[model samples]
Structures are given as C-alpha cells and as structure tokens.
Target chain A: MVNMLSIKNLHAGIEEKNILKGLDLTINPGEVHAIMGPNGAGKSTLGYVLSGRDGYEVTEGEATLNGQDLLDMEIEERAVAGLFLAFQYPVEIPGVSNMVFMKESVNAARIARGQEEYTAGEFLKLAKEACKQVQLPLDFLKRGVNEGFSGGEKKRNEIMQMILLQPSICFLDETDSGLDVDALKTVADGVNSQRSPERSFVVVTHYQRLLDYIKPDFVHILADGKIIKSGDASLALKIENEGYGFLGLNYVEEKA
Target chain B: MSQWLEDVIAHAEQPASNELAATWLAEQRNSSLKKLKEQKWPTRRTEAWANTSLVSVESRNAKPTPANITSWDKPAIPGLDSIDIYFVGGQLKTDLSTFTLPEGLSIYTLQDEKAEAVAASRFAQIKPERHIFGLINDAIANSGVVIDVAENAIIDTPIRLIHLANDGVENHSRVLVNVAKHAKVTIIEHGVGEEDSVNTSMSEFDVADNATLYHYRFALFTQKALHVGGCHFQVGASSYINSTIVAFGSDLSKLNIDVNYTGEHSNVDINAMYLLAEGEAFDLQSTIEHAVPNGTSNEKVHGIIGDRARANFGGRIHIHRDAQKTLAQLNNRNLLLSRRALINTKPELEIYADDVRCAHGATIAEIDDESLYYLLTRGIPRSQALIMLNFGFIQELINDIEIDPIRAWLTDMLSTRFKSMEVS
Candidate 1:
C-alpha cells in the first residue's frame, strides 16, 4: 500500500543554515509515529518544509502525501490536500471570530475538494461538537481567533480545528509542551479519538509523558538533523528512563 | 485664497428674498459672513488642516442644482423603523406634514417660527470658530432643520436625516437637535453623494441633564464629491451619550467631532471608523473636553488605508483644572494595505487636573505576516485570507454598534469595500 506520508533524503532549513540532513521517514495510513528529538534536531523543520511555509527552504528532498508532491503546492493548497500542522504557537487574530475563521477555512477546503460547502447551521453544529470534544467552551467559538487564549486553550483550539478540518495527515509540533497534566490528556484524547485507518499522525515531542496517553506504533530518535534510531513504542520508555545517555548523545531538558 | 472662496463670499453677500433669510438666522449669518471674511483660507501651513487640502472645495465650480429637479433615493436601514427626513439639493424634500411624529417629539424647518428662538442660542454656537468651512457653512447654509425632544420623553422611533446631492451641485445642510432633561432619543445623520459636488453638512446636538442620546453619522461620499462636515455635542450632567461615525473618503472629505462635558458624572463614547482606497483621502479630528469633575470619555478611532489612499486622524482629550476625577482614553489604530498608502495619526492629551486619569495612543501598522499565514494555513485562499485579516481589524468597533441593522449594513458595505481594495 502507498504510504500516507513519504519523506526521502529530505534536507531542509530556514534561511541559510541547513537543519535536516538526509532525514528519511514514512508514515503508513492509520499509524501513529512519535518523533523524539532534542533542541535544534530539525524535527519541526520537517513539518514546516512539507507544509510549504514561507522561508522554509527545501534544499534537497522529496516529500509526498498519497503520491502527490507536497513541496510544490502553496501553504493553503497543501492544507486543502489533507495536510494539517498544529502549530506550537498558534497566532491570535484579534478581530476575526473563531467560528467565522473556521467556517471560511473549512469551506475553502471543501470547495477545493469539489465537495459542497457547509451551511451556517451545519458548520456551527460541527464546530460545537469539535469544541466540546476538546473541552473548550462553546462561547470560544464566538470569541476572536485565539485572542487572549491561554497556552493550554490555544493548544486545545488547534486540536479543535484539526477535528473540524478532518485532514488526512496531522503534524503535531510540540503540542504536548506547555500543557498541564489535564490539558495533555485532553489533547491526547482529542488526537486518539480521530485515529482511523485512513488518517495518520506524526506527533513531535520532547518528553515521553504524552506517549502514555496516545500510544505510538513507532518511535524514532532524531538527533543532529537525522533519525539515528527507530524502534517500537518501547523505545520511548527507554528514553524516558535513560535520557539518551547510552547513545553518547546530549539530552536537553524540556523547557518549563 | 482661490476664486472659489471669493465666489462663495460674493454669493453669501448677495441679497435674497427667501423666507429663511428673513428670520433671526440672518443676523447670525451676517456675523458668520464677517468671520469668514476675516478668516484666511486654510493652507498646508495651517495646523488643523495640515494633512488635508481644501483644493477640491476651493476649485469646484458646481452650481447648486435646482431644488425639486433631482430625484432622491432615500436610503433604508433594514428592519429599522425610522422617521425619515430627506434633503435634496440643499432643500427639505420630505413633506413633514404627511407623517405624525412620536409623542413629545417635534421636527420643523429652520424657517419655522419656532426656529428663531432655537437659532438664537444654537445657530453656530456649539461648533468651534476654528473651522473656516464651518464659518462658511454658517454663512451660506439656508436649508436646515431643528429637532426637539421634550423632557422625560422616550422616543422609540429613530429620526433619520438623509442628505443627497446631484452631480455638479453645491449643497450646504445643517441640523440642530435638542434632547430635554431625562429624555432619550436616537438620531442618524446619513449622507451619500459621489459626484463632482460640494457639501458642507453640519449638525449640533444638545443633550440635557439626565438624558440619553444615541447618535450615528455616516459620511458615505466618494470619488469627486467634496464633503466638509462637523458634529458637535454638548453633553449635560449625569447624562450618557454614545456616538458612532462611519466615513468613506472622497475627493476631499473632513469631519470634526467635538464632545464637551458640560456637567459632572456624564459619559461619552465616540467610535469612528474610516476606509479609504484608490486616491481617496479622509481626515477625522475628534476632541473631547472634560470641564467638570467625575466625567468620563472614551474615543476609539480605527481606519484602513489601501492603494494610494491617505487617512489622517487627530484625537485630542482635554481635562480642565476642575475636572479632578475625569477619566478619558483615546486610541487610534490604522492599517495600510499598500506600501504607497499613507496614514497620519496623532493622539493628544492635555490635562490640567492632576488627579485625572487620561491616556492616548496611536499606531499605524501593516497586515501582520504571521496572522496572514495563520489564516492561509487554515486552507483559506490568499485573497479571502487577506480580506478576513483586514476586516478583522475593524470588526471590533463594528461589533460595538448597539443597533443591529446599522451594524449589519456597515459590515456588508465594508466587506464589499475590502474585497475591492484587495482584488485590485
């Protein structure tokens, strides 16, 4: 079967410096892949390069989503083609309400896919359900997009958006950071609930605490811009206990 | 001064047999005419008119269109039951005798016998003498109306003042509104014209003690029309006044909004929004005076300038010595959609009272790249995302409008404007 996401010899960086050097990974449909990395390991750069974010230069790489070239499309076009990136720091749009923003986003994606757009009532119903799934209040839908939202709330809002958009491939960039025990579980549950045979997840995290809630089918240790080791879920527990000291690698403590 | 000013003076000096010229306004007009003569026309060197030019108003040679010759399309506010008064070509086109007003409410032309007494105290008094066009308006404005709301009366139906002018016409319009003690009323001043025309539209509102006033001023002229107007309010003690202003730029358009706190414990909220595109220009000057103790005022001015359009805003808050407990805040924020677009913003606070709380801030910014990318990442097209982000900056104030119909109408109009500005 064709992989859900295939990245081969991916060498990318922001601006002049190269970060990802010959990084290779493949995610099959319905599989959960956890990428464990230290600071400056180029884990997040992979997501940015695939999403076609401006300034993220793909120096040498071949990244595809379901056999389609992801690097050649616009950021919005990639999003419409079932690519979702849950930002580590979501931006705040002060005047655009969350509901209106999501409506436009979802409708745009639907139209690009040749599907009928959701009516106002239909969109609201879907949004409310997604809001509830992530433990966000319904009123958050009425507030400005992530305006004045707490760190945990913003993370949950991203999950809420992912739930509503229903993209095929999701890249969770350090989503487990800055979240409390309760919020981490809420986010993990939100992600786990969406797991299906047709959807894939690439969860990038520094700590293994989140892996306890959402089990990963495979775990890879990314160090020095490349994945040096790959194992099953047990490898995450070993890192939690050993802290990368056995591999002669330095482990940067998670940020508070 | 250009020949336009000279011609206006000559026209004001010419004798007329109109019934309005025979009223007490005649004396006030003569005094204003004297001031207009003494006052030098504003130039780029003038402080108040620094960023705005009077070239269009000074060069236009549009003859006043004959009254009753032009057809006026009255604007409607969806779901708003309002008593409409139409003014076309500087003349009252609405037949007031056809509709009965609400209880304790009165509306009449300035030529009516009751206006002589009203004009004596309010003709040109509320508006400051600093504006040369105001003086010109006082001298040449012959078509006007006076509105009165009795004490303790609550007028549910809004009074809409609609002004329209044909192309190549010079129209001067005026309105005076008096809300007595303990009364409440809603007044909307709506003007629309986009021709090679000149309009000096002015209105003065006197809100008495313990009263409430909801006011809206929509300056919807664009292209070749030259509009110079002012809305002045004297807020009484223990009263509440909420005023909202929405304006689009024209060949030359300027608006002055002055709120004077005449009584203690009064509150005034002034929210102004302007959108200018192409070669349009809009100048907005708002001043709030706290002359008494325990008064509060808030002013929020937001604008979007696109293409080569230019916008200027001057917000001044003055607290007097006796206003020990005054609280005032003014914030002006602008967004320039193009590198060629320009915005000149100045926020000033003059406080003599040491114990008062006052703050002012102004900011001119471009569309945030992070915010734009955030929206784009959500699968919204670049153009749609651009509009969403642009309109987001103005939606805060539009959401503050208490009138639903007005808010909806403004949102639709501004969205259309944003789409045009972005697509081009």
Candidate 2:
C-alpha cells in the first residue's frame, strides 16, 4: 500500500538553529499517528516545515505527499496539493468573515484541482453543516475569522475548516493544548468523523491525556530533534504512567 | 513669486462682468485680495505645504468654461432619492423652477436676494486665513449655493451638491449651509473631474444649538486634474456633527478640514480616507478645536498608497485652557503597497486644560507577512488574499457609515479602484 506522507531525514531549521534534525516519519492511508514529546522536541517545527512556512529552511531531506514533491511547491500550491496544517495559535483576521474566507479557500483549492467550484448556496449549505458538527452557532459564519474567539472556539474553528476543505492529510499542531475535556472530546469527535481510507492525520501533542480520546493507531516519542522510540498505543500508556524519566531524560514542562 | 500667483492676482484684480456684489461680500473679497497680495507663495519651507507641489495648478492653461453646459453625466446613488443640485464648470445647472422646495428647507444661489443674509454671515468666515487657494476662491468665486434648514425641522431627503470640472478651466466653487436650532439634515458634497483643469471647491457649515448634521464629501479626480479645497464647520451648544470624507488622488489634490466646538456639550466625529494609485498624490490636513468645557472630538484618518503614489496626512487636536473636561483623540494609519510608494503622517495634540483627555497616534506599515501566510495556508492565492486583506483594512471605516446606499456605492467604487492599483 502506498504511503500517504513520507518524510526521510528531514533536517529543517529556522534562522541559524536546527530544530528538526535528521527526522524520519511515514504515515499510511487511514492511519492515526500521535506524536508525543517533551518541550523543544521539534514536533511543531515538523508541521511548519512540511507546510512550507517562510523562514523554515529544509537543509537536507525529502518530504512528499502521495507522489508530489511538496518542497518544490509554493505555500499555497502545497495547500492545493492536499497538505493542511491546523495552526496551534490560529490568526485573527478582524475584517474577513469566516464564511467568506472558507469559501475563497475552498474555491481556490477546487480551481487548482481542475474541479467545479461550489456555488454560494451549495457552499452555504456545507458551511452550515460543518458549523453544526462543531456545535458552533451558525452566526459565527458571519463573524470575522477567529476574531475574538476563545481558545476552545479557535480549536473548533480549525476543525471546521478541515471539514470544509477535506484535505487528504492533516497535521494538527498542538490543537488540543488549550482545550478543556469537553472541547478535547468535541475536537476528537470531529477528527474521527472525517477518518476514511483516503485520509490520514498527524496529531502532535505534549500531553498523553488527548490520546485517550483520539486513540492513535501508532505512537512515537520524539526528543532532541529526532524520534527516539516508536510503539503501539500501549507506549503512550507507559509514558503517561512513568513520564520521560524512564527514558533517562528530564521532563521539563513547556513554558508558556 | 510664482507666475501662477501673478496671473491669479491679475485675474482677481479684473472686475466681474456684472459687478453688483453685496456690501458684505465686497468687503470680504477686498480683505481676501489684500491678504493674497501680502502672502508669499508656499515653497518647501512652508510647514503646511511641505510635501505637496503646486506645479500642476501653475502650468495649466486658463480657459473659462462656457455657461450652462449641462452635458456632463451625473452619478446617482441607487435607492438614495436625494435632492440633486448640479454644478458643472462652476455654474449651477439645476433650475430652481424644476422642483418645489421641501417645507422648512431653502436652497438659493449666492447671487439671489434671498441668500443675502446667509452669504453675509458665512462667506469667508470660518475657514482659516492662511490658505492661498481659499483666499483666491474668496476673491473671485461668483458661483455658489446657500442652504438653510428652519428650526425644529427634520429633513428626510439628503441634499446633494455635485461639482464637475471641465477641461482647461479654472473652476472656483463655494457652498455655505446653516442648520437651525433643533433641526436635522444630511448633505453630500460630490466632486468628480477628469481633465487638465484646476478647481478649488470650498464649503462651510454652521450647525446651530441642539441640531444634527450628517455630511459626506467625495473628491473623485485623477490623471491631469488638480483640486485644492476646504471644508469648515462650527458646532453650537449640544449639537452633533458626523462627517465622512473620501478621496481618490488626482495629479495634485489637497484638502483642509477645520471643526471648531464653540459651545459646551457639543460633539464631532470625523472619518477620512484617501486612496492613491500610480503617480497620483493626495495631501490632507485637519484640525479639531475643543474651545469650551465638556466638548468632545474624534478623528480617524486612513490611507492606501500604491504604485509610485504619494500620500500625506496631518492631524491636530487642540484643547484650550477654558475647555476643561474635554475629550479629544486623533488616529492616522497608512499602508504602502510598493517600495516606491511614499507616506508622510504627523499627528499632533496641544492641550492647555489640565483636566482634558487627548491622545494622538500615527503609523505607516506594509502588508503583514504573518497574515499573508495565514491566508495562503488556507489555499487562497496570493493575489486574491492581498486584495482581501487590503480591502479589509479600509472596510473598518466604511462599516461606520450609517447610510446604506452610499456605503454600498462606496464599497463597489473603492474596490474597483483598489484592484486597479499596482501592489508589489
């Protein structure tokens, strides 16, 4: 079976320091992969580098989605090629409405894919349905994008975008960080609803609590810019039970 | 002295063909002529005109536009149903006999006998004396309008004053308005021109005690047209004035606005926007004075400079010693879309009252890369995302407009203008 995402020896950094040094990962179709790490483990850096964010330099490595060379495309081109990054701290665009923004993004992706663009009525229908699934009020569609949204609401908004765009592979960059128990379950349920044979997910988090709801098929421990260990769901249970000290490493909580 | 000044003086010295000026107007013109003679032409040393040039107004050939040429098209605001008054080439085109006057509302030409008292009271009264173009306008502007609203009257329909400039003509236009006590009215000053011409359009308003005035001024000119104008207002006790000013830069366009709060408990709010493209230039200066206690004034100015265009904004708020408990604020923000585009912004606050609250800020910025990246990650193309972001910046001010049709008209008009601008 073909891999949905493949990253080999990914050595990327921002400004002079290398954060993702010699990292490798593979994600198969329909599989859920949870990345667990302590502070400064390059988890978020991996997501940013894969999404082609500016200032993130891939010094030595190859990353591809399906058969396309993701590194060769522009940021929006990479997005059009079915790569999505759910920002940990979503940006607030005070004047651009959420509904209008999603419609533009959806039609932009569709135009690049040589597919038919969604009409206003059709897009409105889909947007309303997505808002319902996230349990957000429909009036949020008319409000500014992420403007004045609370932490949980921002995370849910990211999922709403995911539902509307329907990208092939998604990287949730600490999306569960600020969410409460109820919000985490709502977010996990949104992700679970989109799981299919043609879709894959990379969930990055600092805590093991979120793993209980999402139930990742595979778990990996990343430390010091590389993956140090890989196992099944039980590995997450072990880390939760015994912290990072069993691996002979100091467990420093990330500073805000 | 510049040759343009010499020629303008010569033109002002020549008597009008039918010189039957009223006693008050004649005295005002003579004083204005004396001031013009003593004032030196503005050079780079002039603080108020430091970043603007008068070459476009200087080099134009002077030609008097023919009388009553009403062939020009008038822009209509859909669903507004305003009472339109047209002035083409500094001449009134609307015939007074064509429509009946709404009750308690009166419109008259400056030369009409019925407008004598208003013209005498407000001809050159409120505008500052330092403006050379305004002085020239006072000396020779024979075409103007006077509008009066009676006490305790509420005018439903807006009064529109449309001025159109013709090629090679030196058009000097003027307007004076009086809103009586407890009355309410809306006025729109619409100016549009596209020619190798120069125009100075000045207007003044007196909002009386407990009255309300909603005002808008649109300066729509580009290419070879040149415009220098002023809008002045005097707020009475407990009165309110809400004004919006929009401009599209011409070869050289300069506008000055002055608002004075003469009575206590009066309030004034102003929002001004300028959009410049290509080699166009726009210079805007506004001053709000809180002269009495418990008066408040707020001014917000924003601009977009694209291509090789240039924009300048100067905002001043003054709280006098007697104006205790005054609240005044001024904010100016600009966006430069190209490396060659230029913006100069200066916001000033002068307060002599110890109990007053006054603050001013100015900022010039480029497109934010983080916001751009955020949009790109959502699959929107770079160009489309830019238009969205740029328009979003100005939409904040547009949303403040209370009139639905005018707001919608401006949204459509400005979006087209914004799209045509070159952003690097």
Candidate 3:
C-alpha cells in the first residue's frame, strides 16, 4: 500500500506567521482522510500549501504526490502533477465562460501528460455529462466562470472540475461551510462517485456533518498547526458529540 | 505658425483636381481652411490632447499626392458579405469596387453632382471651431462617399467603406450617411495603411425620426502609420444610433467621436475597443450631448495595452437644462499587459438637468493575480491564462455585436493580435 500523498514535518506559513507547524500526514490510495480542527487550526493552510499557492512558504517540510516533490513545482505544474484543491471561495471570473475554461484546463492537463487533446465537440460532450452529474444546467457552461453563482453552485462547480480533471489527490477546503443539507449531500455524492482505488482525497472541514456523508477512512484532529489526535470514523462522531472542549486540547500559537 | 500647420494649409489650397466643387462645399472648405490657418494643430498643451502628442505625425512630412490608382485585388474580410467600396491612396477606385444598391438606397462619390448637394448641406452642419482635425479633413479631403437610405427603407447588408493608404502619402477621406425617417441601415468603415503613411478621415451621420443606424469602424495600420479620424452623429426623435470603433496596429492614432440627440426620446450607444502593442499609441475623445428631454446615451471604451504602448480615453456626457429625463452612462475600462504600458482614461459628466441620470466611471487595472492563479490551479499555464483574461475583458463589449460575420471577423482579428503579441 503505497502512500499517494505524503507530508512530513510540513512547517508552512503565510508571511511571517507560522500556520502549518510540523504537520505530518500520509494518505494511501483509495482512502479518504478528513482533517478536522478548531478555529485558526491551519486547516485551509494545509490545502493551500499542498496546491502550491503563493504567499504560503513551506519553511521546513517535505510534501510529495506519488514521490514527486510538490513544493518545488509551479502552481500549474503541481496541478498537472495530479494535485487539485477545491477552494473554499471559488473566484468569479467575469469574461471566461465555464465551457472555455474547462476545455482549456482539461486540454492543458492532457497535453502536459502527453495525451491527445479533445476537440471542441468531444469536450462539449464530456462537459455536458459532468454538468448533468453535478445537477447544473447545460447553460451554465456558457456563462462566466462562477460569476453570480450561489455558494452551493460554486461548491458544486469545484466538484465538477475535480471530476473532470480526475486528479490523483483532491483537497476539499471547507467545501461544506456554507452549503445546506441538500447541497452538502450533492457535493458528497459527487465526491463519492469519483472515489477509486487509485485515487485519494483530503477533506478539510471544521464540522463533522460532511464526514458522515463521505465516510473518511481516517480522521485526524488538527490543532495548532499539527495533528494532535488520530483515530477512525468514531473520532468524528465523538468530536461532534462532545466538541473540541472534551479533548482537553490547549491551542498555543507557535512562533517561527 | 509651425511647419506642420503651414504644410497643412498649403495642402488644402492646392486641391480641386478631381471635380468641380459645389458652391456650398467650396464655402465650407474655405471657412474650414480659414479656421485651420488661425489655429495650430492640437498639441500637448491642449487639455484634450494632454496625454497624446502630435510630434510624430507632424514630423512624418507626408504630403497630399495625386491619386495613384493601382490595379489591386479586392480585399476580403472573412465571414462578411458586404457592399464593398474601396478608396486607395485617397482616391475612390470605382473600377475595383462592386456594389448593387437595393431600391430606396443610394450611394455615390462626393464628386458626383447628385451627392454634392447632400454632402454640402451636411458639411455645413459640422462646427470647425473646436475640432482641428475635422477642419483639416474638410479642408483637404480628396475623396469621399455619400450614402442615403430612403424613408421607411430597411437595408439588411452592411455598406463597407475600405480605405487603403500607400507610404509617404496623406490620405484624407470623408463619409456622409443619411438615414431617412423610419429607415434602418448599417455602415462599416475599414481602414488599412502602409508604413509611414498618414490617414485622416471624417464621417457624419444624420439619423432621422424613428430610424436606426449601426456604424462600425475598424482601423488597422502598420506601426509607422498615423491615423486621425472623427465620427459625428445627429440623432433625431425616437431614433436609435449605435457606433463601435475598433482600433488596432498604428504608430499614433487619434479618433474624435461626437453624438448629439436633437429630438426627444432619441437613444445612442457608443462603444470602442483599442488593442495596442509595441510603440503604438491610441487616443479617443468622445462626447455625447443630450439637448432635448427624454434622451438616452451609453458609452463604453475598453483598451488593452502591452509592450510600452500607450492608450488614452476621454469621454464626456452633457445634458442641457431642458434635457430632463435624460439617462446617460459612460464607462472606460483598461487593462495593462506590461509594467511599461500606460493608460490614461477620464470620464466627464456635465448635467444641467435636475432630473437626469448621468453616471461616469473610469478604471485602469492589470490582470488580477488571484484570477490568474485560479486558472493556473486548473492546469492552464500563466501565459494562456493571461490571454484568456485579457480576451474576456474585451469580450464583454464584443459579445453585444449582433452581426455574426462582423463579430466573427473581430474575434479572429483579436485572437491574431493576441498571438502576435505573445510571440513578441
């Protein structure tokens, strides 16, 4: 059982503030890992660091996707190397249509992997199916990317991209934060449909409601930039029942 | 006076070889020349021309030459089926042109006796007090066109005006469009010039009551060429007028557009897009005036500048005291592709009417890094992402074009320009 994504002593920070302090995690293929944490626990920072976003410097750490160093690659390079981060707040681009953006993204990834590019007709066919799967109308493809979209729709749009790109490692950063029950279920179902033996997922959430639908194989409680506790699915249920207070964890800010 | 002003006056005085000028036209040209002699060319000292300089155009030393009508192939615009009219070296090429005017629509050269009367009347309406370029164009224009659409007539095909200039020559042309009451028409003015040539053109539109007019201008020239042009609109009661100007490729280009609502309930839409790269300079000065009540006007200008290019946009909207219920909006949005690229945009709204709704906004910005990163996270490279964002910025206005062929041609032109810029 090889680890699809491995992070060891991942000390990452934004500007001068250390957020991810000495974090360590290993996600194996076909496994869903949920990272639950209290407020300011660096849950979103972990996702940003993994996807190679700017402003997040990995001070001292090792992060790899299938043994390839992720921290050394450009943002687009990391994306082509099978790392996808579902942003908590998807950006609204006013002029680029969803269809055009998706086609370009898909083709760029394919070309990077030495695969043949999809023709317009072929891309349209695939995008239509993906839109249907996400319960988004086909007309959404013609509109600007996420422009004037509802919160639930944006979350679902992120899922649609993840499904289309089919990256080996997916990071969902607080995707369920503003979603209602129906939206949550839809997003969870979309994630479930993409679960495969060769794919891995890192679901970062502050609440345990999403974990109930996705059913992560491992649950890690992140506190103060590190995973302070690790357990099976029952840990989530326990945290939902007793809250982070019951764990008796003291969150001390780490100085760089 | 400067050498440029002297040369311009000399060029205007030596004209009239093509045909006998009508009495009204001769008077108009004489008055314009008198005004030109009294005033020098617009310089940086002028408020409207502060961001633009005429030094390059003045130094070109291009003189008005006799018409060198060469046998040339008809220019083709992809996806466009239009009545093509060609003017080469500032002279109308009737043998090379092809057009069959439908009933109720008439087209003629300014030299024709039938067109001279209408041209003279329209020429008299242009005020030469402020616009030096308009005065210069009227004083020395060697070739021009007059198009008239009869009352209640609707012409489906666009009337295309193609002006091609050769090097070391000054090409001055004019166009007069008269849309009768309850009529509809579209006109496309396309200009291309060789390196180091100078092009000065002016077009006037008379839109009558209950009439609609669509005017599109595409100016593409070499890097060494200079383009100076103007478009004026007189909109009547309940009439609708739409004009779009697309400027790409030139050393120095300046366009002055004026729209005046003469009757109540008249509406005007003025939109322009300029794409400049590598030593290019473009300046647009537009004014929309609402004289009567219930007038509406909208003006939008978008610019993309790259590689030391400079773009200037000045839009002014005026509502008179009696022009109550006037709704006017002016917006100028610019995107700078490189650090050295410069953009100067100003939107001015002067409303004397208490009940008018007039708003103006101007913004100059580079592509957002967050948006670029968002696209990069989806596997698109930085360069491609920039192109997408840049295109998207201009596409907002391009999408409003209802003509399929014209829209397609513009999209192709923009993409080609983008690709060329990427390589350089």
Q: Of the true interface contacts, what fraction does each candidate have? A: 0.85, 0.75, 0.90
Candidate 3 per-residue lDDT over residues A21-129, each given as its tens digit = 9999999999999999887889988988887888899999899889888899999999999999999999999878999999999999999989999999999999999
Over the true interface, candidate 2 deviates by an RMSD, in Å, of 0.7
* DockQ-derived CAPRI band for the predicted complex in model 1: medium
RMSD of 2: 4.5
- What are the per-residue Cα lDDT tens digits for candidate 1 across A1-256? 8888999999888769888999999999999999997787888888788888888898897999998998889999999999999999999998789999999999999999899999999999999999999999899999999999999999999999999999999999999989999999999999999999999999999888999998999999998889999999999999998988776797665343
Clash pairs of candidate 3? none
Per-residue lDDT for B72 in model 3? 46
CAPRI class of candidate 2: medium
Query: lDDT tens string, model 2, A32-124?
Result: 999988888899888889889999999999998997789888999988889889999999988789999999999999998899999999999
Give the per-residue lDDT of model 1 (tens digit) for B1-424.
8778887787788776233464678888888999999999889999999999887777655353235535756778788889988777788877877979879898878777776665678878988888888898888776788898999999998899987777777678889999999999999999888977788889999999999999999999899888999999999999999999999998799999988888899999988999998999999998888889999998889899999999989988888999999989999999888999999999999999999888889988887888888888889998789878877658789999998988998988887888788423
**DockQ rank order:** 3, 1, 2
Model 3 — interface RMS deviation? 0.8
- Model 1 ranges off by over 4 Å: A1-3, A7-13, A16-26, A34-41, A57-63, A67-69, A92-157, A177-190, A206-256, B17-20, B62-69, B380-393
Q: Work out the TM-score per prediction.
A: 0.86, 0.83, 0.85
lDDT of 3 by residue, B1-424 (tens): 4566577778678655323465556777888888778876677888877988888776555476546868644657787888888777788776423555798899877766777656767773743258887888777776888898999999998989887777666678888899999999999998886467778888899999999999998888658778888888888999998888899756678888888888899888888898988888888988888889999988889888888888888888888999999999999988887888888888888889899888889888876878988999999987788889877767778888979878887887886786566422
Q: Which regions of candidate 3 are displaced past 4 Å?
A: A1-3, A7-25, A36-42, A57-63, A67-73, A93-157, A176-189, A206-213, A219-249, A253-256, B15-24, B67-75, B96-99, B338-340, B380-390, B415-424
